[model samples]
Target: MMRRLLVVACVLLPLPAFAHAILTSSKPAAGGSIAAGHQTLDFQYNSKIDHRRSRLTLTGPEGAPVVLTILPSSATNALDAEADLKPGAYTLRWQALALDGHITRGDVPFTVTAP
Candidate 1:
């Protein structure tokens, strides 16, 4: 019975090699505040992103949408864009290719104070 239990546990346990995507960090830090009319918006990922399959967007306080594209280089996989944000709240929604080839996405909110 103990040997059978051990085999079952091993089968149920998470694999040593698994793949997933997560937001390690972000500028403005989700619900953080910053000056309005930001020259650039940034999103950082914990793992490498598949640029060809990634997408990002920034919505203004007025609900206007600004699309951000992928920027992959030797150093990092970052999504960025320039915006003339107005003083108010904004939303950032992002989707990307996980290391395991799955899609992962989430939304975050932030505020842009009037300069």
Candidate 2:
């Protein structure tokens, strides 16, 4: 009975990385440079966000986080963040709960230079 219970626990353990709203990819590929200052940052997720409270941050080269909250009335599949970027590498950090109730968070790096 102990052996069977142990197996069940192992199988049922939450795989947050799999279920959470993982940032599968982003428009400005990680560590890639955007010649034109990114007027917008787009994050593509493995799942839909909670929409009500999803948040995005653009971390400047100096490491200050700039908040880019969604517009609430936007589409469901995509999460958009609008920012006026300067010439520097920026890190994108995001968090959201999926429509399925899984909490997700992660970061992607990008660069912006003079046009």
Candidate 3:
């Protein structure tokens, strides 16, 4: 009876929930530089994400933030986009929604150098 009660208690207890969607890697890496012109913007997370609901915002040296259209991805944990850029400082802001319903946001600051 005691063993059965202990098992029941364990089952009733709430399990600890793990947080989701940490940014693991990015193209034009943070504080890094990339060649100017057409480029691929990629951001990878630690877990699967909902690309449909995610956002990618890019702010250029012109001091304007433009919402970049995210492209369809074969990768479940990465967000991909494309842009035509000039040699300047830029910030890629990302908001990702994980499959588990968690949202994570961050920015990648990088420079675009003359090709």
Question: What does candidate 2's lDDT look like per residue over 81-107, in tens digits?
Answer: 677778887888888877655567888
TM-score of predicted structure 1? 0.73
Q: Per-candidate TM vs. native?
A: 0.73, 0.74, 0.82
Candidate maximizing TM-score: 3
Please name the candidate that would achieve the greatest lDDT relative to the true structure: 3
| Poorest lDDT segment (10 consecutive residues) of candidate 1 | 10-19
lDDT of 1 by residue, 12-104 (tens): 763433244577777767989878764566777766777777887888766777777554542245665566677888888888775455568
- Candidate 3 stretches greater than 4 Å from native: 1-19
lDDT of 3 by residue, 12-84 (tens): 7533232367898899799999999999988988888888899999999999899988888538889999999
Candidates, ranked, lDDT: 3, 2, 1
